[model samples]
Target: EESGSDSSQKQQSSQKSDSKGGSKGEGESENHEYISDAKKVMIEPIEAAQLDINHVVFLDPGKISITCPKDIGEHRSFIYDLETRQVVKLPDNTTVLKKLDNDDLFVMTKENTEYAILDGSSYTVKKAIMRPANVDNSLDISPDGKSIAYVTDEGLFVSDLDFQNPTRIVAAKREGKVFDMELPRFPKWFDANRIGYKVVGFKGVLYCGVVTRDGTVSKTYMEAQDATLYPLVNGDYLFRNDSGKGIGIIDANTGQKKFITESLLDKEGFAFDKNGKWVSYYMTNKEVTEENKWTGRFEVKGISSESKIMEFETEKPNAKPVENAVASPDGKFLLFTDMDMTGRRVLYKLEINAEQSQQSQKK
Candidate 1:
């Protein structure tokens, strides 16, 4: 009788253990499980009081432009001077400049008019006589405010403040080639004298290239899957798809490549801080349920190698978060943007604890 009683007790114990294990697995579906132990921080939506109420920031807010009336040509764009609160409209059929530098902007119009180097704040024509007039051109200013790189005639050109002779960096493709190569997209400034850009993508491949002030080209083996380009920050660059797969990093100067994270395999998009310390992207999973609220996750980090640091699952349901986020040059404040109910983008600022970052490094 004693032996039979012991066997029955053991069986009950085993059954209860199995039941507890099953219950724990079921609970895991709802909560976030950190794949690795990482430090966590909670992010709250801080309010952003507008500095300029008259201008609504557009799809690309890196260069803020004043909103124009409906009748204006669709190609025309505006830039607002943050200091003077003046809005300057470039020539008709001209676009607002991207990649702004201190107090100046570079614009290219339908005819390649040379008037790109202009007062960003006052919108006054600073240099029109030097502009070319017949090619679709795009230009960017180096971060140090010393030089400008503009594209025209299917080639990349660099000029100085005086708008002297423009040097052609990349030759236009041989005219007779059947491929009908397109001129490279606007070059992005990695430093005062270096630029990064990609050739047009074709057949599921994008040729990523980097150029310097002296006109040297270095190519990366990696091919971007889509036409959308990633932003450059600090010394690194981040690229992702809409479903968030194929996210990787490249040396901003040398084009060295490394894979950091892989999530949301079908589509992905990303944003980075000016110093390139923080990067955020979206993820999607078809199997997720309605109660989970969002299909994406946002992560921030101090370095590219420390891939998993601060992660927050989406709190709002079916909301589109800003992927064009920017950091103040000092990295003290982070600006978040998104479209409001009317489908217009709004910018918000968040203050970061600079002291906490310093303390964490000491640990």
Candidate 2:
């Protein structure tokens, strides 16, 4: 483990440009035709009402769940189906926390501090499990819907769907130590038997690691001054490294790292397309921005080849920067929210005709 100051220095050094003095240019735009073929759809309008809609979670390509506040000061959850373009409100006052691979939903109602697993087909509570004491509100269900992992004041714990035979996978090692802290953030099931979590070290260095259900911690795969780990569909973990200077993917089994790109590493906006074959991130022209300072664009690239597939500029000058960009499950649509100058949050979807775009590139 490295000291907090040392880690901060290393992170800054990693972000500094190398001796060659790399050219500060937004490399040649690739697949320009792809951008022309894509279309933007307004899923939700910014001026619709006084409602604050957020927590958009895609259950699949066609279905999404979101949280909206009610007039009574309670939070209501609903699922929107793109196929029918209809939003169906959930029966309970709970908001969805996670949608399992089996389509089951893990939801929490803060009013009663209760957690339940809902059936995918019936939209009914399949089971109500025992709530952990001093819950950190970090919960994740396994893809197979058999196991659930969460965090508590004591430590990280995992149990079967029925909440039987619970096991404390990671002890609260920082408890009672100097600079003690609260529960970890985003304790998630990496696979059926393995989980990953973030914890604060002695010097406040945030460390992320994976552990087995039996309570064995794996070697720390990666660490940074600040990093949030998101498990990919293919079992790899994607995280911004070097204090948000770059994004990298780590092989869960081998601990090998492959950076997607070092350019625009300072931007905090990026997401993998639904199929995980493509990634879209926001970027600004280094040369142009050095002169103008208010210009930026979005870049889409192939994950394996690390090749740019398309690039497009936002609305410009008055363009609202995109935030929380996410791809639909099928990879055809990119969804994100942007707040206008008037402070209105608008949700937009970019539809990609990938097949047509590729054909155009070949021509």
Candidate 3:
């Protein structure tokens, strides 16, 4: 009897072990099944939320970079970062695009004849190009950040960032025809490798083209019948006129086009939202005050028109003009240029709206 009882106990223990093993096997199988059956799609936001805007830093032609205090004075022409708090003093020259590559910067000398690359600590001479006696303009860096493109004497030229050897791309056609083009704006980057700029015709027609770092030219992106269009990055454009109405975009890959609304036409200016879904254009009406000062304010609109989503506004008729609007690559903050009473250009941060901007700010 004792032997039989012991044998029964052993058999019961073996059964319990098998049961637990079965459960373990089932749990493992269930985990695998859950992983395999699950599906996910990522959605990114477009228009962002508003935050307390402040000026972070300043860059100038003096080759000095300074962090700005909350109180700024008038007669200021510099640039800075909003988030990182980096500042660069532009040379007394035409040194735009304040912060150079996370730490350094570039400047055109006040004489507007020579250019330089500077860091906070020190700067190196980049190059000197022949300046025309009368034409006023600026310089631009290639999108890939490898070269510099600028116009001298109404002619266009490209050189490495280091300013080694210079090559002229555009030459004057006649006495009044600088490059024989009408729009007198500096070049802008399409990719790190190409630049888009306008060529003005004698007939007042604006012709836009893409030039490679190696100096190859593509056909005009768009031509206005009698108007001029400034190319914006990521397939959009700003139509500059007395009415300010001709903003549109053409896809770099597929050549698609879209135009802005008339409301956003006259005082409308655009900067890309942080997510790159929409470019925010501000619209304002002209007004005058009892103090005899010109007072004007504008509204902010994130355009996702291809997908039909518009969000946010400054909401007051007499707010302020939006200026120098730029976007962070991640599409989170639109760094805009604003002025205090002192007339200095300072950077302001506007957060992007996540849910709707991501959903609607589509191609």
On lDDT, the candidate that comes out on top is 2
Best by TM-score: 2
Model 3, TM vs. native: 0.55
* Runs in model 1 lying further than 4 Å from the true structure: 1-102, 105-123, 129-134, 142-148, 152-154, 159-164, 172-183, 216-236, 239-244, 252-255, 264-269, 286-294, 305-318, 341-344, 352-363
Question: Local distance difference test, per candidate?
Answer: 0.47, 0.60, 0.43
User: C-alpha displacement of 70 in model 2, angstroms?
Assistant: 3.7
When 1 and 2 are scored with TM-score, the better candidate is 2
How far is 140's C-alpha from truth in model 3 (Å)? 2.4
Backbone Cα, N, C clashes tallied per candidate: 14, 0, 37
TM-score of 1: 0.56
Greater TM-score among 1 and 3 belongs to 1
Q: Can you write out model 3's per-residue Cα lDDT over 216-260, one digit (the tens) per residue? A: 655455533333445555555544433454445555544445555
| Model 1 / residue 187 / CA error / Å | 1.5
Give the per-residue lDDT digits (tens) of candidate 1, residues 241-354.
433454666665565656555554233224445555555455545454445424545544444543343333444455554433545455554444444433434444433443
Worst ten-residue run, lDDT, model 3? Answer: 38-47
* Cα RMSD for candidates in order: 13.2, 11.0, 19.6
